[model samples]
Target: MSQFAGLAVELEESGVKHEMITYSGAPHAFTVFGSDRYREDADKKSWMAFTGFLEEKTGVKAM
Candidate 1:
């Protein structure tokens, strides 16, 4: 999530338009387990933080 937050911040700082997508349910199911290796408690937190940062930075509601 921190990574994504950073990206969003970078994009905003650079004057670029960007959008972020977040998913519910088991992460593995959504990606066909593609994120198996990347899944972690910290990653989940990062994602949440990223979403929050995106909303605050872009003034866009997250779906």
Candidate 2:
């Protein structure tokens, strides 16, 4: 497994609550808009996940 995947597994085993989202075929910095490595699908999905998590925790929806 990749390093981050291993870390996620460890966190689960240790009872740490967290979310892990991975984008297949997304290069590094895929979330950076307008960059050469930007991936629209991955970027949008990741942004949604991030905002959703924040809303879930703080009960404030992102604009």
Which candidate should be chosen as best, given lDDT against the real structure? 2
What is candidate 2's CA lDDT for residue 49? 89
- Backbone clash pairs for candidate 1 read 1-46, 1-47
Residue-by-residue lDDT tens digits, candidate 2, 1-63: 399889998999999988777898898899787899999999898889889989998999999
Stretches of candidate 2 above 4 Å error?
none
Model 1 agreement with the true structure over 1-63: per-residue lDDT tens digits: 688789989999999987766543335344233456454554666567778899998999776
All candidates' lDDT scores? 0.67, 0.88
What's the TM-score of every candidate structure? 0.40, 0.79
Candidate 1 to truth, TM: 0.40
